[model samples]
Target: MPLVRIKSLPFDHEVPVPQVISALSQAISDAANIEQQHIMVTWEYLAQSHYSHHGQVAANQPINTHPLLIDLIAPNFNTEKQIASMLELIAHTIAEQVPIAKNNIFINFTPAYSDGVYDEGHIVEWDM
Candidate 1:
């Protein structure tokens, strides 16, 4: 399972949040070659006043200055190339679905050992 947490200011009113989440989840599922149901994508909206850039509050700066931060946590089974490809795909998908500039999107990947994750009432164990 892959868990994605997207943090950013609220999106423009033109795009529905649910649509963006669905697109992101689908893109991750496809890039990771995992089942769609295994991917979880969530967005955490940061109030403009709560975010900062270069010591300047987001509310005081241009919206473009605010960055889209993404945290991807998944099993540590993927190769380096696979991880890179997955991040690229997710970034592209976000750019397409949202108004954020591609450069302003940042993704941090954190790999979790299978046994470290608990799901469905038990620890996760990957079948080799």
Candidate 2:
């Protein structure tokens, strides 16, 4: 099981949630070599007024300095090179979908033991 959670300032009207989700899932699946069916992507938008950076509210700013957080939980751990490649893919995909600096994107990968991740009441396990 792999869960991808994207957290950022409230999306503007132009930001298409479905497309963003699809792109993220596809990018992650391809980069991580994971099955698309096992990947889950979700997002939560925070009001700019409630999200602050350097003690300043980002509500009225044209470009938010606040970082976009991408949390990924997967059953398998990856090499540092693999993770780096995945992060690059994620940053590019997100930037293409929304207006955010690539440097402001932060992706955290958490590796889950098979026993800890489940789907449809069945625990996740490596096929090979």
Candidate 3:
């Protein structure tokens, strides 16, 4: 299972949450080499002013410096190439719906215990 969090500067306008969720799930599944049904993704939009770059507020600028920040947690058995592929897919997927540049996207992945994650007192299993 994979849990993903995406944080980005607010869009010029609103975006449908369902679309974002679907796009992310598909991209993450491709990147992480996992079944799409097992991936979970959530996102938030932050004002540029809420973040900083080199001690300067990004919101004061006309352009965004750090447009996207992604946090992902998943099993640790993926190969290096698989991880890289996932990041690339994530960036491309977000860019297809947002105006952020791929270079400005930042993603961090955490290795998680396969059976440690639980919801409602039941352990999450990779049954598929």
Candidate 1 structure quality by residue, lDDT tens digits, 26-63: 87776667898889999888875888777877652243
- Spell out the clash pairs found in candidate 1: none
In the order shown, the candidates' Cα RMSDs to the true structure are: 1.9, 2.2, 3.1
Predicted model with the maximum lDDT = 1
Candidate 3 lDDT over residue span 1-128, tens digit each: 77888986666566676797798898776655678877889887776589876676665322347657898777777667766777778778877776666777889988776687785468865542
* Model 2 residue-pair collision total: 0
lDDT of 2: 0.77
Error of 1 at 14 (Å): 4.2
Across 25-121, the per-residue lDDT of candidate 2 in tens digits comes to 9888777778898889998887768877778777632344788888877656566787677768878898887888777887898877756766887
Candidate 1 Cα outliers beyond 4 Å, as residue runs:
12-14, 60-63
**C-alpha RMSD of candidate 2:** 2.2
Q: Quote the lDDT for 47 in model 1.
A: 73
Clashing pairs in 2: none
- Model 2 alpha-carbon drift over 4 Å, by segment: 60-64
TM-score of 1: 0.90
**Model 3 off-target regions past 4 Å?**
30-33, 60-64, 125-128
